[model samples]
Target: MSRYQQASHVFWRCQYHIVWTPKYRFRILKDNVGKEVWRCIQVYSAQLGCEVVELNVQIDHVHLVIKVPPKISISKLMGALKGKIALKLFSKFPHLRKNKMWGNRFWQRGYFVDSVGINEDIIRRYVRHQEKMERQEQAELALD
Candidate 1:
């Protein structure tokens, strides 16, 4: 294969982090629509030339770690993923409109992104800690 073809054929890995919450941090994402929202994110990410490495859907927000090719711009990729997902989600879940998931918009505005390196330990810890933190929050809430 030519160099260009070889490069294109080779998988490029990147980690994309995204976070968005319901207006006023409402826990509307605990229902069936929550799963749908996550599926939408996965579909949109694939369309943007990325593979999801990990995803965490909290009660209020979401976190995603994805792998993407070098050819795609972060901004364009995020735009496509968030935009398409939001459009589809709001369309399918009409209640989202009432909640104002977006203040006249879908997603907040921007998301967090991180480049993963060879630090497997760090990545694992972060992913694990995400869940732990969620559990802790739930526990604390239960006490209240």
Candidate 2:
């Protein structure tokens, strides 16, 4: 079951796959930390009239499939999302600051985002595969 969004004069299904990681590739996102990051993304995305179709929060990176409106620029949306998450995470978990030895930053300087259209299902499958791969990698590392 898929739904499309509508504005005053336009009907659209503008979706994107966005991925980003923490600075220095730290593995600090776990337990309560991961939960807070998810919450922040959900709250911020909703504020922009966007819906999170799928989201995956890994220890070092986060991925999301978001349904956005055509009115907003992708860069603007990402900036707001990243900025809000960084501010909230820093405030909610002060210990996170210690990991930022180089500078007071949460996320890396850049992100990966792709527009999703007819290949939406393909993108979802890719995200799911990412989770599986990460789990397998962790299990293998644990055995080492």
Candidate 3:
């Protein structure tokens, strides 16, 4: 049971199971590289206000369970996470670019995203509340 996030009229617990892989599914995420990947995920996720509930960096692919806010789009969230991790990973381990990758591309294009939990009604209610709060905030700001 994850803690629910509350803001004005909104209350949510948005969690997702995300999976992705390196270019060509290479078994390069080992030893230091694996450790670095985990670190990057935590650091980058924190910067984006997302909580990583669980993470596993296998040799070829990575699995992550993350909780994000309702206002953030899945595409934007994934893009930021993958982009920052790749940038940092490449910079820290330049040797990876020698032959494993090309043109600074580390992780492959596109990823898998699945909303966690089985309570669709709960998520729906939270989304509705979040929208209502946003509208109210905008109205209040407009009055000033």
lDDT of 3 by residue, 7-78 (tens): 688999888878898989988899999999989899988888888777777778887878898888889988
Q: Count clashing residue pairs per candidate.
A: 0, 0, 0
- For every model shown, what is its TM-score relative to the native structure? 0.76, 0.88, 0.77
- Over 25-94, each residue of candidate 2 has an lDDT whose tens digit, in order, gives 8887789999999999999999998899899898889989998889888899889988898888888888
Range of the 10 consecutive residues with the lowest summed lDDT in candidate 3:
122-131
lDDT of 3 at 134: 61
- lDDT of model 3, residue 130: 50
RMSD of every prediction: 4.2, 2.3, 16.1
Q: Which structure among the candidates has the greatest TM-score?
A: 2
lDDT of 2: 0.87
State how far residue 50 of model 3 sits from its true place (Å).
0.6
Task: Report model 1's TM-score to 2 decimal places.
Answer: 0.76
**Model 1 regions more than 4 Å off:** 1-6, 9-11, 137-144
> Residue 41 CA error for candidate 2 (Å)?
0.6
State model 1's lDDT: 0.70
